[model samples]
Target chain A: MDRPTNQKAWFLVLPVLLLVAFSAVIPLMTVVNYSVQDTFGNNEFFWAGTAWFEEILHSQRFHEALARNLIFSAIILAIQIPLGIVVALSMPRKGIGVSICLVLMALPLLIPWNVVGTIWQVFGRVDIGLLGHTLEAIGIDYNYVRDPLDAWFTIILMDVWHWTSLVALLCYAGLVSIPEAYYQAARIDGASRWAVFRYIQLPKMNRVLLIAVLLRFMDSFMIYTEPFVVTGGGPGNSTTFLSIDLVKMAVGQFDLGPAAAMSIVYFLVVLLFSWIFYTVMTNFERGGQ
Target chain B: MNFAWMAWTAPTAIFFATIFLILVGMGVWEYARPGGAPRVGILRFETTRGDRLFVSLLGSAFICLAWLGLVGPNLWWALGLSLVYAVLVFRWV
Candidate 1:
């Protein structure tokens, strides 16, 4: 009812349409073109059909990287969602303390991805970095560069540091938007703190948590810069995510057709998973309603 | 106009154009039928017409990919499978 009957609103979408065409559509079409063709040298292309796609699908390298990505995403979701919820819950609801908490929470997110990677890369150096040095001083063996376990730890820690704030901020927004009346009613009913949260808060936070989970899942799944900078997809490909492997294939090896095919596959996988998450969540929400 | 660097070829161009046309057609269909009432199909979850369309398209992509990976590169059979899948999705998804 709020929308105008006139169609003039569509004209406003033109700029965004043009932007998408230039930014996403054209580049994606180029990748699609490359995916189907083999390029030797001198810019000559021959039709390769689904050869590259088949190769990528059959490759153990692709499967391993995909597994690593999925595991990393799962781990981060497990850690960050609960941590974010707790952080949001503990945060003061009002006053200057709220602003302080928000600013502090937002600080890590404001740092660029590559910078976060660099920071973690240096910070996990056993020789010089505070965290690594302290761990070493405490007789803890920690060398991200030398050990796969340490590398995984550093990468996971870095990702959690970089992205947990996003979940927290989103959940905070959800928490604040919850009416005071609900809390008051819960109090009047002599509900426990757990009951208040379980009944009054979690239900209200369902939508925002969906957004957070999807965003976190997608971001962590496609994560490249931080993990790449920190571990360089090592110690020996342990931290090699889909994006890292794609970059290694496309730029490092210059296998254009195979890389492009992998890119398409990766894109489709993300799209499919995101859609599934959205559908399932919305369906669940609908059932609840 | 100057898209030579993108290495546009006849087949690729046609492919993308087909996708574009399908999207435009979908838009037109939606505009014509304003109320896209959600329906519970054989999948047991409620889905609108657009959702069914999306499921069909995404599922078709997977089917084609799986066929390419498992069977030979002769995509004719894959396309046939995709068509049948799409029809089923639209009809009973």
Candidate 2:
């Protein structure tokens, strides 16, 4: 498993390094520039120091958006992870059904984000949409456009439909990778299904589950397009998660300085959470080992 | 079952077409240059060119989505971010 220390490997890395630099580093630098400087029309900018950053940090708007984002992510993780695990467990482990099931499960993940939003938007309309019409027929008031709870329900459902497959797929891969010998040992021990899963399967799937959780958390935290397209962050800013609020600031209102500062803070928060998740998970893994 | 309304405007169609073409081109490239001996990057696992391609493409799509959602409909920033994502995927993923 020891790799030879070959400097020539840098040649292999050069292409990717250049590509990342061109894309990520440059724009990030621009954000940094905007964060510290004040800009007027005609591209004129003046030094603003940390005024924008301080303002954004102290702003109630930012706090509300951040709170919404945290709550949404928490809800998504709670629902998706357990639901995905259950789905993965129930999926056919052997036979042609396996491939068919996997492909069907993966369909949602491949749809473009905007397209998903559009689909949900149309699907949730009270008049034309099936669910909305059915709910109304059943004597349940269901209007995502007007009701904040309904809007949240629709958005959460849309996310669950779009992303649960990812968690399921990851867990399925982990499940499939479990060695047959482990199952055989469990059988020899006359272990119950729950016992087998708890001790053998769950432990085996830990790494992939961590990946699924981390991905879901970060993605749900940064989510914007699907909800935006569906709700426009409306019903009175009720659904305005941090990304949506950030977009409104940077794009809608053209508040560059504060937006840039907020962007930096947002990026840092995401990085911090991801780092914490990774560190804690990896530490737990090492401790178990 | 009518599908005609799904037709995209010229710019959107062209952009998506180009992405599809690039993915096809990558497939062709892979066929031409077979197994890219797996190498370790930032992650502990060794990845081949195909894995790198998957990561880059997915990452690029995310970059574009985030850009459109957060920075406005203007795509120049998204393209820049995607290019960086592709490089990072190749370099590290």
DockQ leader: 1
B10-93 per-residue lDDT for model 1 (tens digits): 878987888789888887876776556578998779888888888888898899999988887888899899889989988887
**Clash list (residue pairs), candidate 1:** none
Q: Relative to the unseen true structure, what is the C-alpha lDDT of residue B66 in candidate 1, on a scale of 0 to 100?
A: 93
- Provide DockQ values for all models, in the order shown: 0.57, 0.02
CAPRI category for model 2: incorrect
Candidate 2, B20-73: lDDT as tens digits = 798788767755665564786776655678767766765665565456445555
In order, the Cα lDDT scores of the candidates are: 0.89, 0.83
- Looking at model 2 chain A, which ten-residue stretch has the lowest summed lDDT? A1-10
Please give, for residues A1-289, the per-residue lDDT of candidate 1 as tens digits. Answer: 1323777888999999999989998899999999989887677888887889999999999999999988888899999999999999999997999999999999998999899989999999988899899999999999999899999999988888888888999999999999989989998999999999988788788899999989998998899899888888998888889999999988988899999999999999999989978888877777766
Who wins the lDDT comparison? 1
iRMSD per prediction, in order: 3.0, 15.0
lDDT per residue as tens, model 2, A28-141: 766766776676656667777557766776688898999998899999999999999999999999999999999999999999999999999999999999889988999999
